[model samples]
Target: MPFIPTLTLKDRLPRPFKIRWLRELMDLVDELYFEYGIVHQDIAGRNLFISDTTGSILLCDFAFSAQIGTVRHGQSVYLGEIPRCNDVKGTMFFLYYLITRDPQYSRYLLSDVDENTIMDRPKWVKHAGVELDYDVDTFYNELMAWVRKRRDSPKLAHYTLAPRHFEIPDPPEDGMEGWYLGRSHTMREMEAGRTTLSWERPPASKWDKSRKLLATGKYADERPPVRLMHVPDPKKGFPQMGMTNAALRGQDKRKQTQDVVGTEDEAEASKRRREEADE
Candidate 1:
């Protein structure tokens, strides 16, 4: 899918079918890594696409793809194509940051940096007491090493300098990530009545209870039926900007206000403000 899609990845992640899709997805990546010596360094949600029919999945956006060093005899040689590594910067860094939760890749710090602003986070590896080349191979190798650490860890907290255990994906099964170890999804379903959904206790009707007086010329009536409000597909018929006309209009008004108040206009407004300030 495009970097930005109408449906946010967060919305798709909860559905049972989506979970299966995710498992296949990681497997697909692993397959690509081993078979093709290709590591889809950019493994974020935006890089994924879910087919509406059959709930099929796809991995796209090869703008950052590279045929890195292969896994010989089932080894994790994450060193990507060494020759053209310098060209890659954002994609691998993103994966490393997510898998490790390293603060260097924290959204708070790395969000604003651009190609012109700064180079890759070689410092990130350096800070960790590892010497790394300034290429995609180095980036991939370093990141994989970090991932292995978390894959074998107790808690998945990223380290600043040293490698720690990481949260590893359980070995793929029939190309799926089987039931999670935790009850997070099950608990969420219970809270939302998605599991073993059954009507627990019956509610008393108005006729079953003594009628009470009301202010309007109204009489006690049965409680309204519970109507389920299904959330619309996040990407479903998304508007050009995922916005309503009223919201856009409000933004337009705000821009007008900002233009009237912002720095660039101050010079012109200064004359009028000075006239008013004097008066």
Candidate 2:
């Protein structure tokens, strides 16, 4: 998908914005909840974006999103029990924050906070700096009606099956073993060289970090000698050296080894060596 430049709603806060934009956001929430049968577990200022070109509200960040009625063991966030209410409640708190700029209600854990706490408030005092196209009542009334519609139509909200369902395909074989569930491979098979394997996108695990150790039976510790660009002053005499020429000569041969272990710098190696000596 082509990337479209957009700014988050939070970035544009305390500035005047159209009330219709927020209503559009509520429309998006309605579609995701009822039509798509997906629950965007996170609906907040940061996750909401206003298009730079189109001036429309765009909901992003599906990292915490899941299909409605999906329950899995070890999953921290699930929308199974309350299939359709998660996004609605989140939209309520988000709208509250947008108008009043009061984030105190949002800080509470989703499980602990009740949407009614905001809905039940007699009035929402808009911040002095904040501006909206329509009166606050217009927005609140529409939200109240949206919440009521969802609450009253429990049957529509609690549909066991979605209109559309998708299945995730199995991961293609990586040449380590045969295609079978939980099939175990020997250490030799697991480490089979990747030069023979064809991959669309190779895994970083296939890069051999310990190639020098495995081939030479000893790790490379020496770094390439630093060559000074300027000649030393004759008056001050030359600095003391520790096998500078031999270090320079072997530099070319150890280039490959250095390439593999370049991430470990000299300072870190010295610190590690000092720690080992102390031990």
Instruction: State the C-alpha lDDT per candidate.
Output: 0.43, 0.64
- Give candidate 1 regions above 4 Å deviation: 1-18, 69-279
Residue pairs with backbone overlap in model 1: 68-80, 68-81, 85-136, 149-165, 149-166, 150-165, 150-166, 150-167, 151-166, 151-168
Local accuracy of candidate 2 as per-residue lDDT tens digits, 141-256: 88889888876865443324656545434446555554433433343455774333333433447535754332333336535689889764443323223324444346545433
The true-versus-predicted C-alpha distance at residue 176 of model 2, in Å, is: 17
Q: Cα miss at 95, model 1 (Å)?
A: 11
Question: Distance from true position, residue 216, model 1, in Å?
Answer: 60
Model 1 lowest lDDT segment of ten: 156-165
Best candidate per lDDT, number?
2
lDDT (10s digit) by residue, model 1, range 226-259: 9997653332221223344654446644333443
lDDT of 1: 0.43
- In TM-score terms, candidate 2 sits at 0.55
Which residue pairs in candidate 2 collide?
A: none
